[model samples]
Target: MANENTDEGLKRVVGVSGLALSIVNGVIGSGIFVLPAIVGIAMGAFGVFGYIACSIILAAIMLCYAEIGSRVTTSGGSYAYVEAAFGNFFGFVINWLFTFGWGILGSAAVMNILADSLAILFPGFANPLIRGFLFFVLIGFMVLINILGTKQGIGLVKLITVIKLLPLLAIIIFGFSQVKTGNLHWEHAPSLKTFGDTALILFYAFAGFETSLGVSGEFKNPKRTVPLGICVGGIVVLIVYMLLQIVTQGVLGAEMATFKDAPLAAVAEKIVGPVGATILLITAAVSCFGSVSADVMATPRTLFAAANDGLFPKFLSKVHPKFATPYLAVLTYGTLIFIVSISGGFKQLAILASAAILLVYLAVILATIKLRMKKQDAGEKTFRIPGGLVFPFIGIAAIIWLLTSLSKWEILSTIIFIAIVCIIYLIMKKFQNKKPVETTLETIL
Candidate 1:
């Protein structure tokens, strides 16, 4: 089939390395740096175990997504997968909420970190207005970098990923040596009552693994690569998170680490002194920056796909003549992030964004089952998930359990976001009633 859009041939050449980098970039963001403190506060010495439990659950969820990605290679991630298995309208609503709602908020959280770090480095620059302006400027810089196209954007992700991991690795190595295991009180087990909150917080840390699925169209061999990347990348992050938590607990103990906002930095100072702490601070900033870059690269593809299908403003689908990239969509998402950054603080947006993505995750798990049954007659299987059908079934069940664990406010906010997206989707459907149907599995693959 001939490519429909003139610029549709602008392929993203992200191989296994780029895919792994994107996953790490997605997982490591602001959450790892700050979330340990919250987890410690809630779960105490047992927070490390909570992290491990969340990692296992996330790995199961990733298995479901890997099945979907193997079956349908597309740019919109869960939206495209669910749409392919379900229907266009349902997919549109899900995609709309995923991209417009959560994507914008996630980007804003990263920008918030950049702004906060800048304020810390130069105390006089802490004015709200100045911080807001600088936040937008930082978003613009990332937008421009992505506008240069996928390879360029991935290159930037690689650089920042390396820079971000250095201090984290240093902390784990040096901080472990300073551990006084007596601080881990065996009696201080995390109560089962707080498991729900721990799961919610852990969700934030693992929320971005789906990002690798977003660029499925760009992978050299998505079936093999996406699953491998998701599994390997997830394990890598799980180890990193675990090590960081262990070092934090061992070095600072549950009490001090739980209280400090910059727990890892505090540990670094104790182990390797002030200079080490400074390096960790810089790493946190770079980690946020790298996540922003990866988000810039991947999320706009959803807008581009939506626009191509007549679900969004058509112009957003237009690729840049020079860069062969979705310039308009990138700017559109960036603008939303800028507004959110100025209007609200990072912590609120981060939690809300995590909630939104969790909703999309539920859809992805169901989509996996639907596609498996729908495509069974097709007799085409490049990669089947281990444990036959049992794994995917358990995965879907786990997601449902997690969904109910969300706080009442998070659930209410998610509903409102979904309703708003449905309203917009209906409006677009009415306007494009006479237009040719544009979304198809073949075109997307």
Candidate 2:
């Protein structure tokens, strides 16, 4: 339970392009492909406004991450930042919430989506046995790729990202020409509750960018790389989301909600007929795989980092002598995803992922404020948010507003999950025979 080893053999080879593409893959996942229809159904033509609002809110949140990520260049992205600002206890809580609560649930949901998407092209994938087999094959491939090396893992992500974007870009380019101006007209503005709910759902599409930073320990010149990569990647995501919404809404019009299951493909079909729909289906599968590939490449580092900090099993921190990767952590995380994906009920739990990620963002934003005030890494140069406390305060308020959109059941579930995490922490602490490190705001600052 001693913090004796920290990033002992992890390579600092990830540069700006690798980091930014990883962020792009992480953010532009299965959610974007289907959320557009839901948003269109909820707010009609005004849904574009919801996308913009979420983008602004996320921009503020990412600014906080940019600052904190630069200041604390460790493996566990959000966990590392909060641990630096606070201490082990809060860090442990965030670790469970971020890594398991959000990461596993979100990725498993994507894996299921991948199976469903593939099933459209090949009906065999619909069978439980075949679907389970597909999950094993895909998950095992990702696990093996990551265990081989970070470079190889990220290389696969890059390939799949390009493959996934082509059909989406094709739809955007062709679908815009087929837009009926009358379809974009609306009679009334959405209510406050409707808009907030729409924005909350859109926020999930942007949530995975933080997971990409989980490999901060393997980043070269993190102070520069983290902020720059986040800025570039964020801009690309905003543009893509805005264009996709405009094209889909403009073409589909009031009937956007009718294709909720495969909205993007509907747009593709409208753009170029049946062939376009087929292409989009393949793209959906590729996009899901790409996102999970990035997740596999990065999120396990949270386990490795936590293990090094003595918060998790020591074996999770072990680096492969040949590959210099956190091989065990990668295997453990991949195994969890496989089990969850094959278990076949994660779609409902996907809501928990949204709630959990909002909490993680809240913690990171708060950590940003505290870390800045305390000047945790005063000796090192780091990116600082332009506004004194304005953005952080805005991020906090925005997160709180989004949390209100959650149903009571989700709220209760998150509370219960946190209680379970706390109990686990206490058990771990007892087993390690170490007293909890008292970490109050006053002491941290």
Candidate 3:
């Protein structure tokens, strides 16, 4: 057994397949299951166009991350990249927004959504007390499994990923034969507001690829595999999401836009009957579980990184005495998740997270451009984005343009979130700079 004081850390046990699957798992959460109808309702016949546009945007962002990620071999992912390029303050801000919006509240949303999904099996799950109990249990389960070790946590991700994909694929395969092409027709042109809403929803669906980049330090050949896996994974997920949208939209037709809920299940029932819908519903719940588990595995690394950088409490950086995992960070995240899950206000956090991540993506793209300008002569074996500054520039512009589509409340929430983060950063910086004055008691001792 390895001792806590051995200084051993996370291992490079994850292979190409594991990294690729993690991306797929991270990106294809419960969001995709509901997006078919959401986009269909907004875009009408133009809905597929929105999917294509968002996929391009996401691909550009992922490319920036892939290139930047290859240059650094660290645990913090984007936070590490940004700090190395800009400075510590920028890194702390992004880390704080990410940890608060996505890590804590976002994961809580999944737990609540999973609890709601569980309500399908047991009607009593709709009760607040019972639902809160299950929510606590699920978050606890993820933290405990993760605290045991990375290998074990990733193993769970692999298994749940497979479980998450099967029903979606089944829907696509079977729903095709049952497609009523007449249902695919649109009756009207959507307004600009509709287009904006669809675009935002589509963009949010592709947000989780950073989960893999976070753990690139555990990849055997990060420079080569990180970029390759991300691109491959991005393409794979894009195809899956496109096919899912097409299949669900085709199967449900005009009715999709109004579903506001499990539109995919409605399509399943039309094709495969009640059993298929039940399977899809159960899979949706498990997908939420898988997503929350992925966050538990990846998000705490940001806190661990922050603590090491003196932005957070030192306790968050401690590796488990027996497991070598960032147990304290995991525990911290789990606790916040549990608290937020009880409040049931994750939608607001989800909106704020979506807004914050766009700015974060812009920062990463800028970091990539900065690194390239600096390392033009430093020949390193790193993954390079094809087409140079074109994609990075496009990514930056796209994110800024997308930010305009955010709801007013979301923009306000984002501003508040940033303000809070900056305040905390100032306080931490002051504390880190303060030297202990030798008191009389200390001098006497």
Best by TM-score: 2
Pairs that clash in candidate 1: none
On residues 1-445, what C-alpha lDDT tens digit does candidate 1 reach at each position?
A: 1112233645747777788878998889987877767776777668888887787778778888878887887677888888887888888877866775677777776777776776677775578878877877778988888888777888888898888888888888877788888765557566676877777678667888776566666666676778877877888888898888777877777566444688887888887778766777778778888887888888888877777776778888888887777889888877777888788754564555656676688788878877777635455656667787777666667677777877788788777877877787787777676354454544676
TM-score of 1: 0.90
When summed lDDT is taken over every stretch of 10 residues in candidate 2, the lowest stretch is: 1-10
Candidate 2: C-alpha lDDT = 0.87
**What's the residue-level lDDT of 156 in candidate 1?**
89
Clashing pairs in 2: none
> Candidate 3: lDDT of 72?
76
Candidate 2 residue-wise lDDT, 277-374, digit = tens:
89888888889999999998899999999999999999999999888899999999999999989886677666577678889999999999987777
Error of 1 at 296 (Å): 0.8
What's model 3's overall lDDT?
0.80
Note the Cα lDDT for every prediction shown: 0.76, 0.87, 0.80
Candidate 3's C-alpha runs over 4 A off are 1-8, 185-193, 257-260, 345-351, 376-379, 436-445
- Runs of candidate 2 with Cα error greater than 4 angstroms are 1-7, 345-351, 376-379, 434-445
Candidate 2 Cα RMSD (Å): 5.6
User: TM-score of the candidate numbered 3?
Assistant: 0.92
lDDT of 3 by residue, 79-169 (tens): 8788878989999988877777776777787787787787987899999999988887888999999899877888899999999998888
Off by over 4 Å in 1: 1-7, 254-259, 345-354, 376-381, 434-445
